[model samples]
Target: MSGSGLSSLAAAMESAVQDAPGVRVQTDVLIRAATAIDHSGPGSPDWRARVAGAIEELVAAGLVECPRTKAGWDRRTLPELPHWVRRSAPPVAAPRMTAKPWHHLLHWVPTVDSERRLSSAERGLLDAVNRWLPAADQVPVVPMRERSWGLLGDDKALEKLRSGRLFVPGRLTLELLRCRSTWPPVQQRVLGAGTWLIVENWSTFESLCTAAEADGFDGRIIFGSGNQVGTRLAALADKGDTPASPVLYFGDIDVGGIRAARLAVTTAQGAGWPAIRPCRPLYELALASPHRLRVQPASADTVSWTTAWIAGELGQQVAMCLTRGEAVRQEAVGLEILGPAPFAALVADV
Candidate 1:
């Protein structure tokens, strides 16, 4: 066969394989396609020999594979063709290279973009960081949202800084960003006290505050404002004026409440403070109360941890309550249930 004829036959086979549903093409289909080419007439006896030669060339070049059987080619006679041929592995493209704006941010660049270029939002963030880093020392401490709004024109831009999505430089610390946690409202009964009590619900907080104001409770009383306690627990460390205390948490006896308490414990420990523990007396009071609300069943881990935290009969009861998809809100144990000197009485017991 002429060089152009051989090339045409090979091209036909390639097109047949490409047009097929999958990588593999039947040997007869490829041969039929090659025979259809202008160089090889369908009625010609030597067309199979030409097709077989072209297929061998493609197989030798690694353009296709014959997994079932190898072709045995002979110039004198028609070559043996395999049952099927499959397209070979495609070449892998090299990673796109782009110039980095800062050497320090080499690892921080996102790889999602095909062009290896920063998006408009990312560029804006980098620009803000550049402006802030040069004069970071000169600026006074500000709220995170305030700083975020001023720099990125979006108050929530820096919300994910600690979430690992954004790569902030080691030098550009949260302290420098001044992203302080919003400390919950507190009612202090004792001056320079180390022990503190945190209540979750608003009504419960008000009840606790009333108790604290009446000298019914020692130490300080804080309003956790629900699950926000987990994130804001770090503020206890930020407020240097306050003494490190054994923080006690009281909240709803539900999945969210338990998770929040767990989160607060982890966050407090991470901040070098003592682990937050449950306000046992308050929880027991709430559990025993007639008031009960339907709640989603908690996971085994949550139930197990709640049992472990409370311990013994009370723990088992709490676990059973959780299993039954029932919860006792902290509001159930209000001033009426707790009495005016509830914390003082509990303190005496301790």
Candidate 2:
């Protein structure tokens, strides 16, 4: 090889070693590249002979050490070039395993037809579920009676699934499993990663999600389950910085509204995520909307997180907002406000 050609080959070899850890040079790869490029470009007619000579010099100079497994042309040794030889080179770390989990990027549900072997990440998740669930051994999934997926927190169920001690009636098909009522054939979601926005009524939730999707909201929207909202926040914080969007809370403008806000903030804080904040424009905007004076019911009642928030004037204002005739939901004006460009900007703002 010409001087420049040899230099180029040396550079390529050094890069491979540095970029890929645990991957020593493979003999076949070097032999192929060496022969393919020999005198093909820039190098002299005897480039193959010349390359062989330079490689030998590199080995002799102690800049490249031959692997013990190789015979004659098994040039699989790492080039102990500059950074490769330098003590100052930052230790090539094992691929950084984000202290935060990467379940968002990984999908590992077992399906009936086939078994796409689980990734290391999925196995780790299964292990954690097994360890945390007290009764993960014999989980029962009867038709959910209560509105919420109340059994989700049951450690036994989680553990059983995690340990492979029990299998779902079907393969755990989707990454997310929603709970719903048998009556209207409704479905409410249970778990998710990435981003989730919560809204009160099912209609608004559906409407907003559609607008979000058309506007590119996609899988980021969720039902108005303050308790689950809390759950999502806790899960998120436990993993890392919550995604860019906050746990948006769109509820009626009343006691329930304040309660919703209170619950959101409380659950996030209780789960050790104080950084999570209540999303805006629900009650605060209801206080000004034309629907502000309409009357509504207070029967839905306060949940644990909301009970503590119904104290001060701010709390009273939230209660007042809820007394509307028709729900003046974010879904109504979302096209004007949360259309693709605006909603994306809002997510960025958070």
Q: Identify the candidate with maximal TM-score.
A: 1
lDDT score for residue 104 of model 2: 33
Query: Which lDDT tens digits does candidate 1 get at residues 198-317?
Result: 677878878777766566454776667667775455565556534465678888899888877877776676566765777777877888798788978775446546765655566667
Candidate 1 has its poorest 10 consecutive residues by lDDT at: 69-78
What is the TM-score of each predicted model, taking all chains together? 0.52, 0.33
lDDT (CA) for every model shown?
0.65, 0.41
- Per-residue alpha-carbon lDDT of model 2 for 318-339, expressed as tens digits? 4333422333444444444444
Please state the error at residue 81 of candidate 2 in Å.
73
CA shift at 100, candidate 2, in angstroms? 42
**Residue 262 error, candidate 2, Å:** 2.2
Q: How good is model 1 by TM-score?
A: 0.52
